[model samples]
Target: MSTSASQQADLDPASFRAIADLAYRESGLTLVQEKSSMIQSRLRHRLRDLGLADFAAYCSLVQSDAGQGERRNLISALTTNVSHFFRESHHFDVLRAELDRHLPKLRAGGQLRIWSAGCSNGQEALSAAMTLLDHVPDVARLDLRILATDIDPEVVQFARKATYPERLVRGISPDMLKKYFDQTTEAGHEPSYIAKPVLTDVIRVNELNLLSPWPMRKRFDIIFCRNVVIYFDQRTQEKLWPSFLNALAPDGVLLLGHSERIAEPERYGFTCTGPTTYRPCHALKSTARPEKQKQSEG
Candidate 1:
């Protein structure tokens, strides 16, 4: 590819708007004008792979009836998947502290469901699995499971594979790493580690678009949707709050990204318990919004 031709592959204004609209309608991801360059950079490979010369041709193909499958490809290309094991440590700490109360119920065969919404490459879900294992080594045999879902099928597949480069496991503690991961090397391939069966055994990874209807019938006890909603505009975020609340069990916890706040917690029947952490108002036995406590970093 020549330099000039590559540079010209950038999406034109019309094409950019069409893509942005399609992305929002399909995935609830807000692609503002400023993201045009990012879209161009990310999807430029699609043009090359399809033997197309410019963004116009790429746009036409994606917008046509035959482009249905490419729509998923487009989402996988544009979505960000930056995640690491225990990226936010405090949430796990809180979960650890609270597990005592939940363990007995779980031990008694009560179901304990946790959802890692937008679980990119399985780190967050795996981290939760490790936490559970730390407190209850037999958690996998109990009625406890973590549902890890991402909009990108590629990332979901990566999560299901449960393998990671050595560097990605840096945040894991030495003791935990020894217990939960098995390091291995295949000739000619980079050294990597895979989560132990104990971890993978209790987690289910699947591709799910949050904008579409959820097929889950069971509510979650804890939800980790960090950094997932920042790509959505306020209106879109507002629309999601109710669905999240509905998905959460009574007294269930909701964890959001540091920058993502529930704009109107009371409007969504949520009470802020800690930074980026919320509980349903009904669960607290009060309709009034509680005072916002200082949030811990997670």
Candidate 2:
């Protein structure tokens, strides 16, 4: 392609918005209006690599499924899966507290299950693993498993790798860092950081599309779907709440993003324990037959 033609391949705001809308409808994410700049920065290289003139044609190719494997690549490229270790610190604090309070009842058969929805690049999963180790004795001996999932397959692959640079480990507690991370150097940089054996104990990284059916039929003790629902419109959030509730065990705890909360918590049978945290009503079993039970004598 000519230089001029190559330069023309970059996705413009309108074209990006169109493709984003299509992806959002397919996936139930609402890319913030301000993300246009970030989107352009990220996709410019993809457009050039594909030799497509501007985003409109690229989007057309994506929508048409023109190539054998471009559609999935396109979806993966457009989706944002930004996250860091201990990204939202408060949620982890709450998580530790909840685990301490409920660990005994949940420790049946020496097993406990957790899920980190939208777990980008496995930091949160590693954090969960580290946190579990801190609170539970012989943590490696416990049958603890965490399911880390994201819609973006590329990120899932990266999560499987479980490597990170020093910058990504910022704000992580010093003791946890020394204990869980293996230091290494980058190609030209002096600093290097990566996950140690601690990650292997707790995280199970896999691909999962939140808008679609979850493969895990089993309920979880703690489900962390943080900073994920903010991208979805309220309607989408409303739809997802019930599905999340169904995925939870009777006493399961649900953690949402700091800014995200259901306006009608009662509809989902969630009781607010703190800001942005909820507990599935332990008394209201999903299978209970209220009408069939007789009242006791007064």
- Each model's lDDT comes to 0.86, 0.75
Candidate 2 Cα errors over 4 Å, as ranges: 2-4, 7-14, 32-37, 105-110, 186-190, 282-298
Task: Kindly list the per-residue Cα lDDT of model 2 for residues 233-273, writing each as its tens digit.
Answer: 98999999888888887767788877788776777777666
Candidate 2 pairs with clashing backbones: 9-54, 30-231, 184-192
* Strongest candidate by lDDT: 1
Residue 120 shift from truth in candidate 1, angstroms: 0.7
Give the TM-scores of the predictions, in the order they appear: 0.93, 0.85
Root-mean-square deviation of every model: 2.9, 6.5
List model 1 lDDT by residue over 1-298, tens digit each. Answer: 5545655686899999889989999998888888888889998878777778888887898899999999999999989999888877778866675566578888888988999999999999999999988877777888988999999999999999998888899999999999999998889878989999999988999999998999999999999999999989988899899999999988788989878899778889887877788889887774223324655433
> How well does candidate 1 score on lDDT at residue 72?
92
Task: State residue 288's C-alpha deviation in candidate 2, in Å.
Answer: 18
Task: Give candidate 2's total backbone clashes.
Answer: 3
Off by over 4 Å in 1: 1-8, 286-298
